[model samples]
Target: MSDHRSESSRPARVPEPADPPGTAGARTPEPVPAGVQMSKQSGTPGAAVPEPPKVPAYARQPHPRQPPSPWGPAGRQPSSDLMKIRPAAPGVIPAATLWSVLATALLGALLLGDGIGLNLFLVAVPAALAAYFAAQAAGRRLRPWTAVWAVGGLSLLAVPALRDAGWPVFLAVVSAVAVGSLALHGSRGWLGIFLGSLGLLTSVAGSLGWGAHGVRDRMADSRGRWGVAFRSTVAAVVLLIVFGALFASADAAFADVLGSLIPDVSLGEGPWRLFLGVIGLVGALAAAYTAAAPVRWDALTVPPGPARGRLEWALPLIVLNLLFAGFLAIQLTVLLGGYDKVMAETRLSYAQYAREGFWQLLWATVLTLLVIALALRWAPRGGARDRTLVRSVLGTLCLLTLVVVASALRRLDLYVDAYGLTRLRISVAAVELWLGVVLLLIMAAGVFGAKMLPRGVAVSAAVGVLAFGLASPDGLIAEQNVQRYRDDHSIDIQYLRGLSADAVPALDTLPEPLRSCALDEIQRTLRGSDAPWYATSWGEARARDILGDWDPGARVRNCQELGSGDQGNERGGDGTGGPGGDDSYDPYDPY
Candidate 1:
């Protein structure tokens, strides 16, 4: 009895952990089926069953938090990414990339360094650049395009060698800049590069000007500067050629501007006035197109083509430059009265004119800029702008065409003036018309489309024609006819080269028709070997064909047979006289 009582009072020995749900208890809990949970037991005999191992922090929980399988459960990937860490799929191409790259590559290649080479190189550069730019712009960003850039870059290395031979350094620099800028896709520091270039040019030009005392000396010293500047300006021009930016309405606006704003400048109701007026009218159209232009920095954008190279900024810049040049000429005329040409003494004639022209261009620039601002600030989200421009241009064209017809009908004697109804005049008018239409269309479409057509061609032709004509048969002819001693000397020398005999036959001296027969005879029998050694590059083949009947021996013998103190002896009576007499002629004595 004492022992039982003491045992009962003593604390029970430490109890064991409750068995896991399916495991046996001391009595062997009635074999619980698989699905059913085992009942809890008191610790005394079976304490309230220990809460199911209060979810162990590290241990895998039964629900949802299933352990990863050895079976490699992830689904398969695309074949492109077989590597350890898969790469991203190729990114979408930008819509403008093709156009930009094409323009950059072709223009760079074609106009590479702006005629750094000789005659062949001049034609080759622009063509090559155009093709390359076009190809890139269209599509096909092939390895070939990259190779073109490399070739252009490498060509720069040859500049030093070509320099003394008359190859330009500006082209080399431009080529190098283009390749490098394009290769990096404007990613690498382009700002640093442009600043460096500006520094180089201004510094070099200033240094040359300072070193040389006179304009003559300065020009000789800085031919390289001019060359470089020209190329760079051309490259800059390439940026301005925005595709498709003009119209008929714009032409009317420009006509109004020219007619009303112009000072006492008299175009005088001649064909020339109409021709030039038409061109101005076209410019107005282009201006209108510029007004509604999208935001694009032609100077900054690279990767070349017609759009990027020839169109984007090229046309507008040229117009600006020409205007500037004209204004300078006018100002100079006002001050100096006569001297306008850029001769050996007056090197900055164009620059001087350009300075004044800047004001006129400034007006246009401001007007266009305002339009652009309006576009940005409050452009309506519709086609209202397009419609308005279209109507304006169409109206202008109708008026211009009518005026042109009226002018043509009024002039009968002007036709005799040669230039009145010539192909050149017609071409100028056509160009104006086309430009006007383009400007109007561009106002509707914007800058991107404006440059795609014949804008540059039309404008250049119109201006060039005006220049040539203005300095032409009337004004230019008289100017040229004013022969000083030096001029007379040059003419006498040319005359001597073709003069057949010491005494041209009376008939040969006659102006035309009957004189041609005698002239032909002299050319055939005497000119090749006699008094005049007729070996001009021009007409050499034609002269040979026309004068082939003359006896070479007789011609040579007569040339040397003159009984005077100085006779132009041909052949020196060389025994080698045969057909055409050794394929050479005696030198013509001009003095």
Candidate 2:
């Protein structure tokens, strides 16, 4: 109290020191809490400084809340220029734009010319263009990968070989194009590829109202104009119906002419086909657009939420590995025992032996791959030792599974050799071979960790498929089986005759009656068949030359009826239909 009284008696106030260099002026005042007030300055001599009175909340108006703005609490000042501008384009597309796109696509389809191949090429062009326009309408920029996608798309459209490469090849080409396009447009990775593919499959339905508002508004505006036209058309239609009925009643000839003009088309006829085509084409365009400008799927690349159970990954895989190992042991025994010995021991016919385990082996191979994937995803991360064990087991399982695939392939080969090759067996064999390659890749992934395994597998699978398509397996299979027939005299003449025109050239090597009969059946099948313009390839022309009007269906012949010397003659046959009388048939001959 004495110190306070003494300090209050001082006459002169001390000046505050200046702030240090570079410091901003004294910090702004913080909001004072309620019931608090600034302390009074000491008075001059005996005079006391008056304190500011506290104001009640109701009596005092709070500073008007500053309007919110991105700039700051004070908000941004208006620009000198008065014209208002939009900040940026939104991520979404407008509805009217989509309707316009759909209309453009339908119109394009109508003008693009007929045939699936031509339409496929034509539709792609407009789909890409519409996608671009949609991006612009939505204020988005073209993606960096657009050029790459464009090149790929143009290649697909321009290459006649690729276009005519059959449905499987065509689908592969389409998927590649779609994935490349999506990737260029910013989405990437396996998930992106999957999403892009899904987009292609369902985009048409998915985009049902992608940009509905603008389209609806435009329709509303046009409705007034359309209303008058609609009413007038309805009135004319009513008048025609009424008068036409009367005229029909009066003149039977007129009625007959009217009926002829209108025609009684059924649901299964041309009108339905046209309707379906229109719907299909429109949907295709929508899907293409959606695929090209898909909603963001990149975020899905984020790691999965919550780790899966450790046992779920480990226990099933351990059991599966044991099963696969056991299967491999049995397979090894069969593989080593020689085909004849195994068949004798099992008391099974050659065909039964070949057919028995192939499908089961194939299924097991598929299940092994799934198990590896699951194990990689959820295996216990308890310690380095656990991870090493899992990887070792998975890798071993994959290697063993590959052995199973090889066995399955061997079985298929035997079956094909016995029955003569068919398209189904050949295709399945190719798939199994690819699956083996993929398992080998998975083994590498297990050893080295899955850094680029998915990418490696995808590329390898794509290359394998493209190669398989180009190899013309049908032609190759026929060539091999025909040579086999020449060697063993065990060929199924009936099966050979039943093969598609694809096998005609290969069949030309058979002796007189069989060769002639096979050609005839091929010719008949060719005549009855209708290949689309896009489906025809150079191979078809070669097949036609070999067929040459022979008729297998008209003639029946057994091995003996083909002549006892026929086998000897076929073994020496030249490339021509007539058999050469020497063992000159080279099984290794590619043609």
Candidate 3:
């Protein structure tokens, strides 16, 4: 009885609160099955302690100082975790393989394509491959329609007319953006497409981070194998260089043979070219990888505000409308008056009057477009009177802009007819045409609201430019100029002769005497026996097809014989020429 009393009386043991789940002193609760009985050794008889279910590391709270991860939410992984963990199935392409392929492509591009036209395709092929590799790395799945678009867009470069148009960079940029947007996001909404395309620039640093981590893991696993390979490769390269130099210096015949095999590598140019090639390759790879795996894009959002008050927009628009109305009246009066009378009143020549109005009117059209866009973005909600006034003002502005665009086009056409058609004049004419289309689009948007109008306009304009490039710029210019020459006999043969290989195919469509002269000049430029087979391009191939069995000696002799038979001082005293120029005077100086 006394022993029992002693056991009971010994100060009852008090349990400290068990440490909260993950503290250092916490005990892992033991698992208990249903109906299990606990002994006195347990916290309490007939009671079971159950283990807490494990939580994933990501789900668990991290250390307070640790920043959240750039890639995902867990945080910057510790060295241990980085080594043990695996990225998801997506975006896990083997880094080494991609790098090797890119390196090989860079080497191939450097070895091929001596001519500028061929070089464009060589550069483009690697660029496209890099983009595809990046898409794979980014975990983007290509859809069927997108794949077709990509194929068709790239194939344009292989077309003789399109490639020779000398707009490769322009076409490639637009097409690549279209393809990349399709891959990154299945939708082609303008905002998403543009944002995704822009995001490629920001992805470069992220790609480097991911790639560096992957390389580090690979290096750790096979350090010895890599070390042996690297050492052996370095030794072989060094030995070859030393022996080649020694043998060549010892014998002239050997040096000559070596020169034939390897070519004379300038100490300066060789390193410079190699350095530029490396820079271009790395930049391309970085861009491609970024496009494949884009991070967060800054979304397009409207400015936060209520529509602007009527006082802010109404007064200015009314004044502008009045001004535009007055300008239109004056233009109409000038049109009613004869060309000579208008020029006399303005105290300007026909050429000056035509040139001056086109630029000023074009500028006015651009400014008016900007004003209308701003009004749409910010003009306040109002009563019916206010709304009617706003719409009317906007509608009037659009109408006035159409008039301006038409007048500008007319002026430009007159200028071209007076000076002969040129690349610049033709480009300006195309712009004027696009602006007219945009004005019509703006008018429709005014009635229906402009939520997608800007994007639609951009897409249309880009497509229009691409269509023009594909149709062949040189061909268009030559056709127009040849027609003008037939009408007035005011042609600049020397300028036609000076055009790039792109113009060679087009010149074939000209009349006999002019055609022969143009072909001879172009043939002289392409004459080089050392051009590599890999440098063969669509443009050069087309030129060869048109020119036919060329003999350099015969072409030069024909040109000299033709030069002696010239009729007038059409090309100046010494047959050296351009618009109002001797051989030394540059026609492009006026522009």
Candidate 4:
């Protein structure tokens, strides 16, 4: 029993692996799966140990620690969640851009002194060309549609060169330029067009920094040449001052020659020219930058409003249609069969009858447009049934509103026939006509999908403006009034005097004193110091040619006497201080 215990107490021998011949001193470790503990066996000798399941190589690597955030705990955000803010990348400005900007500056100094005219067209041309070339140099693909907008913009810019109408033409030109710039890369929605146009101010502001950077880089690259040019300019200026004074002191004839050669710029004029030059430079830079990196306004997405139930959507529109239909029936009755009867009942004259409800009808037409726009926004978009309902109800309302537009126009026509065509009357008539066109476009849009409706409306307005400018509103007003004067042997000498130079041709056809009274203001304007060739407009040039030989001073003295004596005999006068009398009449009043 002691021998058995001794044998059991003896330590069991474990097997040892032999190393290779050259690596005998170092023992190789046996491959073990990660995360599996290697515990020594205590039982039978030479028994094989079971292996643990293998772990993936990726799982075997330790996790990397994150770096500390510089912004602190609260300010720290996940990398994926952070929005990146980047400055506009500097681009290589084309040589054409620099030269064009210089040209624009010089032209602005020369032409903008008088007023806007052909000068605007002349200055804008180079800027536009530079933008086109810069866009090409920047490797941007010009959209085909953008060419149309550019053409339209240039055409509108030419309006001041052709017509002498004041604020209306200016507004049209401004709208065209802003919208055309936005469309350079093709905007998607009305919001995109509006916001992108507004952002142009910011673009112009940024151009200063961008242009300065570009100039600095260019100067750095051509430092030697730039220094030479700077020194040469300074030397020339100094030489001219020193030598010019000596020559002027020596000879009075030379001084006269020098005086004629150099323009006499006033202190205020110098700053004005400098301001205009800065405007030109900044405008060209903005155009270049915009063309190079146009905002992707088309990428902006506006989700539609949530759809409503068919009944919920169609009910109000149906009621609106019914209301429009009722108004239409009444308009038809009053306008067609009951005109004389209604006039008799109201105890109103022709002009009074036409002017009474004209404004209310125009407002109704405008408000109807707003209603249609809102209805389209919230209209049901479920299926075929909903689309049909929208088409039917909205279509009827549009048709009825068009009739209302016609009625408004008819009333204005009658008013013009009774009183005469003033700018106010013709302008409102044009607006009513445009609104009628808009309604027709909307009706067409309902038939075809409304996806392009916004753009369509913009295009229509542009077309309308172009047509109005081309037709020459002031000229048309003059022609119509002249025709009325001839037909009735009566005219408003005062009203024609307020017209621009565009009316000169029409007014020149009037007899003697009337012609002189109408052309006096325009002749005085043209007789002033002649504008530079670039600043002169076609209308002003023509006016000068027409009034060159005729003197208005002698005839204008008779205008007051003639106007006062004939005031009561005006066509629409009732001789009781009525619509036609000078005291009661206001040619400028829109309503």
Best by the lDDT measure: 4
lDDT of 1 by residue, 315-382 (tens): 44345445545644544444344223422344543223222232333234334334333332332223
In the predicted model 3, the residue pairs found to clash are 134-292, 138-292
Candidate 2 Cα misplacement greater than 4 A, ranges? 1-119, 122-126, 132-195, 205-284, 298-323, 340-349, 447-461, 496-498, 525-535, 545-591
Which of 1 and 3 is ahead in TM-score? 3
Worst 10 residues of 2 by lDDT: 80-89
lDDT of 4 by residue, 1-591 (tens): 232333433335466666546766653344344346555556534334455445566666799445667676754645631122112453777767766776787777756776777778888888887778767887777676677678877888877888777855686777667766865546657666666665456567666676677678778899997788779988998999899989999999999877655444567788888888778877877877777667666555557678888899889888888888887787677667545755655666656667677889999999999998788788899899989988998899899999899989887876676667777777788889999999998998888876877677777778888888888888988898788777755567777888988999999998887888888888777777456555667887888788886677677886765554543223344442224533335443643
lDDT, candidate 4, at 291: 73
Listed in order, each prediction's TM-score against the native is 0.23, 0.58, 0.63, 0.78
Higher-lDDT candidate of 2 and 3: 3
lDDT computed for candidate 2: 0.57
- Give the Å error, residue 343, model 1: 19
Order the candidates by TM-score, highest first.
4, 3, 2, 1
RMSD of each: 28.5, 16.4, 11.7, 10.7
Task: Report the CA-based lDDT of candidate 3 relative to the real structure.
Answer: 0.59
Where in model 4 is the C-alpha error above 4 Å?
Answer: 1-90, 224-268, 337-342, 564-571, 575-583, 586-591
268-371, model 2: which lDDT tens digit per residue?
55555456446545554464345435555544563533444556666676787788778778777875686676665777655456666787788877877776
Positional deviation of residue 571's Cα in model 2 after best superposition, in angstroms = 21
Query: How high is the CA lDDT of each candidate model?
Result: 0.32, 0.57, 0.59, 0.73
Candidate 3's error at 389, in angstroms?
5.3
